[model samples]
Target: MGAPARKQRSGSRMGARLTVWASDHGRAAVGALGRLARSRVASIMTAGVLGIALALPAAFLLLLDNLERHAGDWDDGAQVSLFLQADVSPEDQAALAASLAERTSIRRTEVVSPDEALEEFQAVAGMDDALAFLDENPLPPLVIVYPVTGTPADEIEALTAEMGEHEAVDTARLDLEWVQRLQAIMELSRRAAWLVVILLAAAVIMVVGNTIRLAIENRREEIVVTKLIGGTNAFIRRPFLYEGAWYGIIGGVLATVLVEGGRLLLSGPLERLASLYQTGPLLTGLGLQGTLALWAAGIALGLCGSWLAVGRHLADIEPR
Candidate 1:
């Protein structure tokens, strides 16, 4: 009799555990589904709004990235032209080119003879007829210098100044002003991209909050009955929070789709533009990390918006 009683007690404990587990999982699943059914139309509308909002900033960021890449190619190949005086001998010009090339900061240097320089100018300027009447070619020899990667602008400027002081060098000019302007523009675009993202996130939260507020108003009577039946505030809030989360997850997915679709739509025009400039293709889509961040941001906005709505309205519908 004692052994039978112990066996029955063990069976009862196992059954209790199973029942608790099943109840918890069933409630979670039903809460999610209930939230979905309660505001299907509102959820869809909010998701669409969020999708469009998120896509705008993402697309702008893609455009900025492509522009930066195109700018980078020109920056990496920054050049300086050293014009030698006509009195400087060819041997001295060659020696100057060799000396500059030997410097750690200088990547490569080439000296162009005076006659060759004249030919190049005439060909480029389309002024061969004007040049034929000259008694002698008046162009100076040139030393073209390429700086090493990651060279500082100040250092390059100093080097140019030093080169200009040389008796053999008539003029020295660094071609880096355009690069500086491009870098400034890229920085401005980056800041603007972030600002746009923040605004869009706020927009998403507002949309979700308004929709949840309407839901609470519609279910005011049900909430009152739950309070009378002894349901805790947490129990009443769980389904609404779950609903907000669902909206966020779905909205994130939709936003990503919109961003990708927009990229595809613009890719052809962008390619044509790049071809005109002889540049590599511009990067136009979010990377894995960016995509993940976007999804998480959407979900968080949805959850916070729903919480705000529930907190503001739930206490008003008491047992009375």
Candidate 2:
């Protein structure tokens, strides 16, 4: 009976301790918010700075996403053209096209006979009169192949090499050099984004740290009094941590608003431009995941900034 009574009392004590802890945190949160309310201009100014820092990187990242999507929409890396031997007749070319249609690697094939190729060159190159003197056609039969989507570059190159070895194929060419260049550009853009993020993150920490240091200075006398009255550092530190967290959360929200507003403002012009480029519309604003990540990043920066400030400055303030 005594053992069960002791167990019950232990459980009750645990529950009461948890309740007290929660109450303290709740009070701290309210106190922190109230402090911000008291100095609205300063809080807004700090948060605005953080928001702008976040928005710059976010905008560039969204632009890169749109460019990537536009490139992908054109199936830029999904085609290879085969120019057949001059001796391969139109009938043979037609038969080769039929055979290519059944191959898994080749999604679609179009056969351009020598005559049609010559006619196109005559029309586009303005060389019809010069070509009229020739007795035989100089252009060869061509087969334009559209590869299945998402086919690896290596596989496509291998297929091109194999097709070039065919007796009927004079040459197989895949104009993927441009695609490679685009991919390189995308890689560079990604690196730039990371660089921007790193610089902005440091800026955020510094901004929050400076703001927190000022707050600590403003309450120096109160801190000294608390120390004299035996208030533990943890107890004294709670409100400041909560205050920093509030700043971070608000800053993140402001950043989201700024980013989305910019996206909306640019949507009309970008959508029209995308139509001209014959790609899907430009990438949209930050989705749920991105918004949440922004908020999380902001909170982390605020906490770290506050922690650094408090650790350095709190040690210097004493009853004396």
Candidate 3:
């Protein structure tokens, strides 16, 4: 009976200690939030700065994503044209076109006979009078081949080279200079987005760090007193960490709002512009995954900033 009673007492003491710890941390977190509320204007202003800094890069990256999505519509998917050897029989041209059409990479193929080619040139160039002087039809049979979905410009060039090696193919041309240029521009945009994000992420860290430093200064006396009364550094650090977390989370929310808000504002005008060209695909806003990532980045940066600030300045106010 005595041993059981002793065990019960030990359990009660441990439970009591756990409760005390829970309340201490809870109170610290709440107190830190209350402090931010007290200085609402300054806190809001600092968060706004961080939000704008984070939003710029995020918006640019979003724009790049949208552009990449619409790259195919921007005339980058040019077709390949194959001309058969002049002496190649009509049966050979048809066979070649039929075989090329069977391949998955070739979206479709159209054969333009010599007579049709001559008629098109005559219509476009108004060269019927000039062509009357020729002894025979000089145009070779033509095979126009389009690329399948997701086929890139380089792959089309490679396909063209492979086609030219065929016995019946006189020449295979894939004039995708414009597509190549667009790909280059897209690559540059990707690099630029990363560069801007890196620069802006550093700015976010600085903004949060400075804000936390000011908060620490305001609580210098309280922190010193807590230390004098034998409060551990970890106990004192909890509020500041929570405070930084609040700032980061709130800033991230503000940044996401700014990005989506701008996207919303532009959607109408953008839709009208796309509609003018008869393209049905509309501008898109951030999806669920992207929105969550934005919030996560904001919170993480906030915690890091707070941790850095507390580590640097909290130790300096050593009850002196």
The pairs that clash in candidate 3 are none
Superposed by TM-score, candidate 2 places the C-alpha of residue 272 at a distance from the truth, in angstroms, of 2.7
| Higher-lDDT candidate of 1 and 3 | 3
How many Å off is the CA of 206 in candidate 2?
0.4
Candidate 1, lDDT over the whole model: 0.83
| Number of the top-ranking candidate, with lDDT as the measure | 2
Using TM-score, give the best candidate's number.
2
lDDT of each: 0.83, 0.87, 0.86
Q: Indicate the residue-level lDDT of 166 in model 2.
A: 83
Candidate 2 lDDT over 1-320, as tens digits, reads 69999999999999999999999999999999999999999999999998898888887887888777766755545678899988887889998888987899888889988888898998899987899999999888899888786666788899889888889998999977777777788889989998999999899988998899999999999999999989999998888888889989999999999999988888899889879977666767789999998899889988888888998899999885
For each candidate in turn, the TM-score is: 0.81, 0.93, 0.87
Higher TM-score: candidate 1 or 3? Answer: 3
C-alpha displacement of 48 in model 1, angstroms?
Answer: 0.5
- Candidate 1 C-alpha lDDT tens digits along 1-320: 69999999999999999999678657855777677767678668877887788778877887887777667667676778999988888889999999999999898998899888888898899988899999997888899998886687788889899888988888999998877787788899899899988988888888888877887898889889999999888878877776777778888888789888878887899899879988777655877887887788777988898899899889888875
- Cα error, residue 61 of model 2, in Å, equals 1.1
TM-score of 3: 0.87
Global fold similarity of model 1 (TM-score): 0.81
lDDT of 3 by residue, 172-272 (tens): 89868888888899999899889988888888888888889988898899899999999888988898888888888788889999999999999889989
